[model samples]
Target: MAMERANLLNMAKLSIKGLIESALSFGRTLDSDYPPLQQFFVVMEHCLKHGLKVKKSFLGFNKSLWGPLELVEKLCPEAAEISASVRDLPGLKTPLGRARAWLRLALMQKRLADYLRLLITRKDLLSDFYENSALMLEEEGAVIVGLLVGLNVIDANLCVKGEDLDSQLTQGDVSVERDTYKQSRQGLDEMYNEVRRQLKEECQLRQDVENELVVQVSMKQEMELAMKLLEKDIHEKQDTLIGLRQQLDEVKAINVEMYQKMQVQTHTHRHIIQQLEMDLKIEREWRQTLQNDLHRERDSVAQLSTEALQINGLKKEFHRLQDENVQLKTICEDQEKALEELGSKLSESKLKIEDIKEANKALQGGQVWLKDKEATHCKLCEKEFSISRRKHHCRNCGEIFCNSCSDNELPLPASPKPVRVCDTCHALLLQRCSSNPT
Candidate 1:
């Protein structure tokens, strides 16, 4: 049973591989302008070859062939549909279908291997079904028998009528036993021949399937090789695409760097140009200032020239003034000598005037002193010649005298013979006269 299961698994795997190979081959042919019918033949060839490979690989599990119909029913239900559809054919419905179905049932029951062997070797009776549609009919009939067995509609004792006959003959009398034996032998032979015919058809159908499977396996291998080649090409193209993309990226980066460098240079150039422009503007202003200073210096020079000319004119006037001053100095010297003489004369005149003034002042002082003395004298004279003393005479002279002078004894002169005399003198004369009086 383990060997049978392993064989089923391997067959399934091969069937799947064949189906895949067929589909791939069909697709390849369709992708081009290849003939459709040719493509179909190629696909069928691939399927047949793959199926044969599966059958050979599973050959050790030949006992599983007894239930090939069961396997077909379970694993390839689509094959069952094809079988059912073909069962309606006139030839397939006749004794051939019934006989094939019975034999498959007996094989699934595993009652007799020799019966199965006899069925597979009978080529003459199987040739009719093989010529009509052996492949389709055999596969379908086997599947039906397997189904019926699984359903318990059939049992391991495939000779159901023979069992009944043996039971009936046992219940009859012993005198007809030899006839029963002969009839039993004939029935077994007939059953064996029919089983042989059906099994031969099944074997032929299996052979045709194996041949088709071989063609399919060959086509499958070729398709697998083509797929490997296509995969390798795709990988190589992908690597080349990646390399080109990397190079493109590097170029873009280089372009970006160059653009940045250019921008920096442009900025630097613009800055330099701006600085030069500023320098030019400053130089222009400086030139204007120098021009203004030059104009001012020219004006100053012109003014200085005018001043020099005026100074020259002033020098000539100064020389003339110096000569005039020298001549005036000479005239001033003569005038100064004359003025000195006049000053000496003026000094003499001043001295004379001073002397006159002094004389006048002295005369005035003398006149004052004289007036003062005359006043004193007049006072004294007035005091002395008082009216009371008048007519006094001197006694000696026998002249009249003041009493005060006469007392002194000095003679007062007689009134001079009209001249007044001191009383004393008068007294003396009187005396002398008296003495000489003869």
Candidate 2:
């Protein structure tokens, strides 16, 4: 589980990093090709490459080139105004727009190429100038190829003619053959077709990358959700444990009280048994005294009848004392039986307490807090939290929500008083109370 979580986190980090790098790289490319509406051209290229819908403002050459053409717009405001009509031209969003942008880019490249060729033709009049112009032309051609390559419009290797031209120009070629120009043009057309092919391939690749990222993100979310559920389960179990601990303490107190009562009952029973023994001892002494008195009376001549009657009464009294002793024995037996039942009940209570302890032990281990407990958005309304819109947690469900969604304070079975809850829980609680009426 730990390894899986780590892998998921790593994948997310890499994905985010890749997106940041791509954006930064694109920004750098635009910055390097600044001045003379380079950024505008680049933006168009980017939109075309990604097949992205261009902003309506982008259709206007002046508006789209606002940064680079700022001076022109300010000095030649009328010209700028007239050029704003160019914005009504097609954009990359439609086929016509895309064709327009492509045509314009192609025309600009062709014009630059022609001017470079003219400079090459006038090499005799400008020897050193010729070399510099040729260099400039080579650089420009390379830049054009780079633009197409960056936009996935052409292959990196398709700039062979640009390299060959740079090599020939470096060797100080005074003249160029018509066949060489044709070859260069052929190379440019091949590069164009390659650009189209690469663009098509890039489109498919972009879709695949988007789908893969989406799937990965979705899987990450599912894993996170599973983790949250596990954590919630753990917290609930911990709460149950806490409750059981409280109950166990209460049971222990009750058991102590019951044990004290049992002790007192046993002590009382012992005192009663001692009193019965003392009574039996005194009765034995009285019977002995009665027997002596009967003997003395029998020794006297005329009191024989009285002594005999007294002897009979003594016997009857002795028999009655024996019956009382038997009744006391029966009462002691009943008391012992009661004590046995009380002991059994105490044992049962102990057993119950042990069972409760075992249950508490069973609930000993689980995580109470989620790893991503502070959600980015409200669970109920699905609104993202901002500086003014703070996240709030529902006390009952432990889910995050906006204040408006979880504003109600309601009583729950788990709480001692009314506490904050979400709308659904509040309604459910109300319905339950109404149904049960207790």
lDDT of each: 0.45, 0.50
- Return the top candidate by lDDT: 2
Q: Per-residue alpha-carbon lDDT of model 1 for 1-438, expressed as tens digits?
A: 333333333332333343335545555312212222222222222221222211223335211121232233343343454334334433343322333343333333443233322332443444432333332123432332232222222122222222222232232323233333344345556656987998998899899989989988998999899889989998998999999999999999999999999999999999999999999999999889778777867886798799899999999999999999999999999899788868866777667555544643453353311222122212212333322333443332323344444444332222223443344454644565455323
Clashes of 2: 4
Cα error, residue 364 of model 2, in Å, equals: 17
| Model 1: residues with Cα > 4 Å off, grouped in runs | 1-308, 341-438
Q: After superposition, how far is residue 124 of candidate 1 from its true place, in Å?
A: 41
Runs in model 2 lying further than 4 Å from the true structure: 1-374
Candidate 2 collision pairs: 60-87, 91-97, 153-195, 154-195
Q: Could you tell me every candidate's TM-score relative to the true structure?
A: 0.15, 0.17
